[model samples]
Target: MDGHPLRLALDLLKGTLALTVHKIRYGLASRLWHGTNLVTEQMSRHTQQVRLLRAGEVLGSLDVSTVRDEIGSRRGTVSFNGCLHQLFSGQPLTRQEKALVLAQLVASFSLTTSYDFADSPLLDGDDRLLMREVLYGAGFAAREMRTFIYQSRQDGQDTTADIESKSTREQTRSATRKLEVVDVSLDEFIRFHDANLAQKHNYRRWDIDAAFVADALALGKARILAARGRSADGLTPQGIQAAMIYTWDDISLKLYRISYDTAKTANPHANKVLIARGMQMAHDLGLLLDTDCAPPGAAILYERFGFPERVRTHYVRATLLSKFAAFIRRDFPSLDRRLRPWVIRAVTRVNRSAA
Candidate 1:
């Protein structure tokens, strides 16, 4: 009885109606409070376009024709531009259609790009395999493989005692004597982020502009944690030793973007405490904890904190020769078989040099 199609349809209908009502209520509230600004306008348009695209995708009607038509009609609009990549992300695409989308993505964002699809968590193995095949067929090669590790809410709970070891508790108390972790305002987060920009990897930069942070906060998607050293007077703190910026996943409520200050610090355990605090926050929120796109040696630290690796995905780039080889393979199949080995060797050399 619970598995009836009518029951499922009713649930879907209710969800759709609830979402529509929520959007209307939020729009009215925003108009009352923010009073309409350029940012608000852009956000509104973006939201509407995304909603349309999502609706199309969910109905299984978002074909290449629809994508091209929308792109043509909404060309240069903030809405379309904001979600152009997303338009194809959730749709089941043919190889040729995927190639076209990949071409557009390369043109808009360069040969190297990494972003979660619109329905990442919902994608099964077949979907992921298709996406991988599409990328491979589009001449992309792996750059770095990042694994996402998650701890279930139930598993994450009851770990307080495990985390607060006698040694760690003593150390934490001692560390807190000289240092404190505090919640930072958006403005403070921005300032700290900007100040530490030079510390981040040049290739793997996370865009942290004020508007983005503000929007994230408004949508309840982000949190900022800062560690400040205590003053001699035991009242005021000194400077920031570390800060962590974590964002929430809407569907899974999983935590992401678990970044911390990389600047040299006197206390080696500062980052550990910050990570522990992040886990606690996740537990408090009754959500899984997830960290994505970690740098080298980061997995070791995360493992130390009880987060085992779950999914490994790679950041890939398409080289000119690889694209040329792919083009040859597609256009001249006979030539491709004869030159495949040479092309592989050439690509390998180029990748090594680039690395």
Candidate 2:
């Protein structure tokens, strides 16, 4: 009531102009979001730098001489045969066996580790060479040791099996071959994948959802292997104890999912057995995975089957607007916090004016 009419109109005009400016800035920011990708590369480079620094520290402390000497001696490889025997025998590998398995896994890991963080510029030439020497030595030793066992069997040499009786050999064979890997229909695979694999953090992160699985099945791009246990009733269908899902992408057979139940009815060694079956299926179909973004467990399984390790590269592209928003939230916290309320009030004022 005390305000001059002209002054009041000028104030209203100022408020409208401020609102218009805010809207224009928001629109510009959004456009900027889609227009930029440099931030993504910068973030990736920083991540690689941190990881490579840690890797360099670990490799620096490694004893390359011992690894080399171990590889030269056939004793380590011969001992690893017992570990493989236990795996195929449906027995839980002992602590020693697990250690041996880790050693074997290092072979595949070493072949790719040096190149994995090639984007990082932090690793000096000498540091990279040290990493290569240690990794390569461990890889060589593992391959030599593991190869010795399998090669012994192929050569008809007296293996760990020689100590066991004929009946024991038959039992081991039966147990290892107990799982039947059969392909299932799309609907059947979906039901199994949804229940067993969908919600798993690793699979979910990779976008292996129902939609992806469905497309894989419908397009005949997948080989869904369901491990059927022995049927209790002669007429009843064999129950599914475990499943492995693989989708063929061009030249590579990508492992999508693999999980097994540990119930009394399920096989104790379903994990290794399913992996073996999956590898056999791959062989039958004439496929090999050049690059598989699977968990370490699955990677170990494939490496055990003599699959070569492949290097992979990932790209990240982010918009300018996203970077701007992140910057605003980080550097101008108060402004960021007030932004939503400002927008709400501006919209309300416009609505009131229209009414």
> Model 2, which residues run further than 4 Å from truth?
1-173, 193-208, 316-355
Q: TM-scores for all candidates? A: 0.50, 0.38
Clashes by residue pair, model 1: none
lDDT of 2 by residue, 1-355 (tens): 1245456445434533433443343233532443311111111111110111111121111101001111111011101001111111123545443333223222222111111111111223543343334333332211211110111122232232421245434443465677666677655755665566545633232221343455455556666777776655645678677776766533335455665665697776555555555444445555543223445765554454444444322211112222233455566789878774664465456546755
- After superposing candidate 1, which stretches have Cα over 4 Å from the reference? 1-124, 134-144, 152-159, 162-178, 193-211, 231-234, 252-265, 314-355
RMSD, each candidate, Å? Answer: 17.0, 22.2
- Residue 311, model 2, lDDT: 35
**lDDT at position 91, candidate 2:** 37
Best by TM-score: 1
Best by lDDT: 1
lDDT, each prediction: 0.46, 0.38
